[model samples]
Target: MNFIKTPTLLKNKSLSLLITARVSSNFAYQMLTVAIGWQMYSLTHSAFYLGLIGLVQFLPMLVLSLFVGHISDRYDRRKIVSISQLVQGICIALLAFGNYNGWITKESFLIMVFFIALAHSFEGPPMQALLPNIVERKIFPKASALVSSASQFAVIVGPGFAGILYSFGASLIYSITAGLLILASVLIIQIHVNKEERKPDPVNLKSFFAGITFIKSRPIILGAISLDLFAVLFGGATALLPIYASSILKIGSFGLGVLRSAPAVGALLMSALLTRKPLKRNVGKIMFTAVVCFGLSTIIFAISKSVIVSFLALFVLGASDVISVVIRSTLVQLETPDNMRGRVSSVNMIFIGTSNQLGEFESGITASLLGTVPAALLGGVGTILVVLIWRKLFSSLFTVDSFEGSKN
Candidate 1:
């Protein structure tokens, strides 16, 4: 269990392959997200349509995350991930085709998004489950950090590059993204995971219910995951960035790229900061403070009209958010037993993924109903409230000893 002693994960050829594949896929996916938002907004000039795009992506993830988590635990994670990537590649190619043919309609593009979400529903849980097996458990923290950092780095690179390509045209961006997916799938074929054999759970309604039941039984994990869900669901402002770029900030696609990349920059920097010396004592307290700061930054961001001020706010928000991410991921990995990492990660995905995609949808809907400023401001307020409520309701689970003391 002293997995840190082994430098194998960092030095292992297979691990290197997996990391490369993940990074490439993530870069393309991040590019696609910003490209889609810009495309939709340019086509319709409405926040509701923006919300609809989020909804299209979120609905499948919400509906299928649990089942996919179960499948990941029960079957071949490598195959699952590879197949999902293949499907996603096809979906992106179709979008590219439509764009090239000048036959793209909003409804048709949204349907493509729906298929992409479906592929993601299967893709995420299995990919996360595959990680613990690829590296030793002791190295899990660093591995997770590297993975998170790699993905965020993609965010930094992808949208920034995409904005420039987007100027050339949406079709070009789609073509590039599709090419990345194909490359990712090829890389996945080179990596391997040792699948755990388990007896199939009963194929019935009870099995589905059991997944939720197991999650409810773990208060620390449940509390941490739920607190994040509520806090993020209410406060995430990513969905409204398009509006901010065009109308409020009076900036173009380049400004939009900077705005989108801001959080990833903060997160990447924090990840590097933590790697120098990992988070030790009072992790729970740190996580709480981070969430509070995330809310505060969002509030500040909502009120800021200046691009420079908003970027600063986003940086803080990203920094705070990554603190919580590292803590929460560590907590889940430490607390969950080995037999159930996939299921647990899948369950975790339900909270985390939904909070992100659905949170985007919520922001979009609220922005459509209320004005964008009010919508964002209200989310910030709600995030603060969630933190306070979680502190009270789950007080006991939110504290941690210093890393040295706990390790003993």
Candidate 2:
């Protein structure tokens, strides 16, 4: 937190507002995730249903990503973000009401998740595109590090808060999440962006596909994005945390909260370090190395029985992931032009977001089929293999020495 005070990027009013908004929104998201995962698992007692949560959320975003990207490129990104937050807040509120009335079912819960995912799909690209506009290019890494820190801090606090609140009732947690989301929306609305005055171009198929085309054209960007996609898809163990908490670890809800927070705690620590000493050399090689560590950590986590060992594995998992996040985010934002940032970011979001959701589904199905231990072990091995294959396929990515050179 002290590092946030030292960064000159925080001195920029708009960037500060953006960071505040991100923290608030991420807090709500983290809380909601805890509540939903717990509720779904408690209701169905099935990992598959928990996995279905990801599937339901993913479908809407997959469908809406291109349109959302196009809108971000053309409209006031601030407004788009604010509106999405408002919609998500409303959805959370409705979910709370349903739960309170005892009318919510698994079917209804999945439906609400779909709506929330729709809002998030719209929110992601513009929010990403909006960052560079608010900060100086020279301090982009610092800004990114601070922003990531805030987000991870929220992750650290939100689930822990949810665990305590959940002892009372899930309705209480949902109500609180709804309020935080609305607050995030208000905070984002206060940030001002200098809108470019340009002739409005008609929406067309070609313009819609521009982001995809641009990413495909740049091998570095493609490499970075795809690397994350496959790595997370195979290595992520998030979807099965509930199973781990209940069956394998026997720690219950509070322990589940701790397990969820472990990664964020590690990420927060790493982000703080990065803010002090941002990566200045061998950025690409560092990213690849971090990902391989992520895979190895996940494997350790998968096999561990002791809570202490599990937490440590997850902590390392989170730490390594933050390294990859900082590097990849900087590359994507700096490499793209202003006009194309929205679209490119949208494409990037699709890749990243899809990997997460689909990864959960993969975890769920694999756990159901192969059992949790083997499934997670398989994922870890797959992640390492993806890294080896990517190293060969995207060899140019590893040679890059600086973020400055990543600019397209």
Candidate 3:
């Protein structure tokens, strides 16, 4: 595979810096997520609290995303991303202190969760919007591939690393995460965002409504969004992993890390393939097939009793889901005007954020009630049904083609 070509975006230096920054920052972030989950479970011993952790983190992102998107359009994206990352670093460091001192009561943890979530709320929209400015339009697919692969690599490393560190001490794991985040912030500061003419301030409610209105009007974008939402919302099996790791799989926290990382492993492998030779043709059909594969894998995972079997199922789920994600993300970026990227991305954030986090909550609550197997099976079934419904509802989008040739 030739990895030395000049990308469509900025010169190689800028893209390299941005990619490194994102990878380092995400590794830290993912590690913290796993550490926090294990810590919370140890503290509360309730699946409801586990679900609540996801909810609390997601709530701020859902609530303030519109404003964040607006800010990204009005000002310097680099600055916004830098500041938010710095704040997040502090937030992670604070958690470490709390862990070390044993001052991490439930309320304190919840408060920290809310604050970190607020940081993410501000950070996500701007960071996503910044991508188009960093890379050339022609190489957007390649850029997306690199980003996706980096994230999956983080997923592969972070959870497993956290599990090992956590065995020694949660505080140690948190401290390491904090250090990595600070390093990531430093790396982000080195990035050079391609400047563009600024848009008018986002002052009016009508404009806010317009952003929402625009997304709703574009059936291709809307369909892509809904497809992800329904599929992830219904097919998500992450929350039940703890149950599997503990009970059925007969492995503890260490095994849980391996299980959780399985999907990222699959994604990382597929992303490598896409990076070398991009999946450009039949994007729409591929997306549907990928979602179907994800659903089937989830169902298989739900029924599997063996740890190895469950991991294989999750690997398939992860690999297939990446195909869907790449296609949806490429479609959104390609179709959206540069000015509207932030707003559209915010809407995108809302759908995905709500689906995954709320889906985690749903899984947790349902598992608490219906049992893990039933919850997993039902979520998979729901995903399959939603795909069928969406295929009929948004049939026009099923023929989505490369932006180079086709007119939307």
Instruction: Pick the winner on lDDT between candidates 2 and 3.
Output: 2
Stretches off by above 4 angstroms in model 1 are: 1-7, 194-199, 402-408
For each candidate in the order shown, give its overall lDDT on alpha carbons: 0.82, 0.88, 0.80
TM-score of 3: 0.95
RMSD of each: 3.0, 1.2, 1.9
The top-ranked prediction according to TM-score is 2
Among all windows of 10 consecutive residues in model 3, the one with the lowest summed lDDT is 1-10
lDDT minimum window of 10 residues, candidate 2: 193-202
TM-score against truth, every candidate: 0.94, 0.98, 0.95
The sequence of per-residue lDDT tens digits that candidate 2 reaches over residues 371-392 is 9988898999999999999999
Model 3 segments more than 4 A misplaced: 1-11, 405-407
Clash totals in order: 0, 0, 3
Tens-place lDDT digits, model 1, residues 100-210: 899888888788889988897888777876776777766666777776776788878887898888988899999999889888888887786654556657667666555
Position 161, candidate 3: lDDT: 81
**lDDT-based ranking, best first?**
2, 1, 3
Alpha carbon lDDT at 110, candidate 2: 90
